[model samples]
Target: MPREISLCDIKGLVGSELGVSAWFTVDQSMVDSFADATNDHQFIHVDPERAAAETSYGGTIAHGFLTLSLLSAMNFDCLPRVREQQMGINYGFEKVRFMTPVKTGSRVRGRFTMAEARFRGPSMVMTTYAVTVEIENERKPALTARWMTLIQFDPKDRPSET
Candidate 1:
């Protein structure tokens, strides 16, 4: 479950470590499903036998985007929720770097650090997080990204004297 925090508490959290998410396994079935969904049926990602013979990964690997897409679930599992937030939008990433291929059957999880938080207007706040998706037993992370999200809430919910 995500920790709950008030809107007024967001700015205070800037530059702090948010939390690490529960580990998620990236298996062959999941890679195949993602390949089918995105029409990205490249051999390296869908064919374990061929991948082992042809690639340095030694087995099928998950797509970088597939790994990136896990951020939402990872965030939900670890990041704090604003008590007054009615909705949140994936405002997109400032940067993303896929540093390592996540091999099939590997476990991965997200490590998040709050980089910045600022009110966008009376009803919205924008936050930036420095995220790294770490692979179990691996020295290098699967990916690193600077993610941004826009949180929406009623202006009336804003703490008074703002």
Candidate 2:
């Protein structure tokens, strides 16, 4: 069974390995959809024939941002939730780098590590996760990023001042 953890539990678990999701495939269709959505119809992303003929990657590659966006799905699958918090927001990314190409029709998985956890009054500022999405069968990672999320807990729900 998977672990069920709350928001407070995460705060106490700073500098620990959070979780990692099972591998997911990046198919050509998905890559094409991302390219259409972003208007980035570069041959490397959408044109399979052109990509095969020209790029050293030897096939269509996924967009870097597309791989970055997978962090959310990976987080949902791997990270334990904060039941008390009504919602969590994607504050921003501290840093992001494309370490290697994610070729279409390849599988990738993300590994998350809890970097820092701090409280800002009622809000929990989590400087979490150097997320590394590794391409299956490839030593080089497809993407890496430092992502942050803010979880807000209601003051009224807290233990009374005593």
**TM-score leader:** 1
lDDT tens readout by residue for model 1, 50-160? 999998988999999999999999999998889999999999999999999999999999999999988878999999999999999999999999999999999998766
Tens-digit per-residue lDDT, 1-162, candidate 2: 136666546656777778888898999999989988999998888888889999898889999999999988988888877767777889899999999989999999999988877666654545566778989999999878888888777755443321
What is the TM-score of each predicted model, taking all chains together?
Answer: 0.96, 0.91
- Point out the worst 10-residue segment of candidate 2 by lDDT: 153-162
Model 1 superposed RMSD (Cα): 1.3
TM accuracy, model 1: 0.96
Give the Cα lDDT of each candidate. Answer: 0.93, 0.81
| Residue 40's lDDT in candidate 2 | 94
- Badly placed stretches (over 4 Å) of model 1 are 160-162
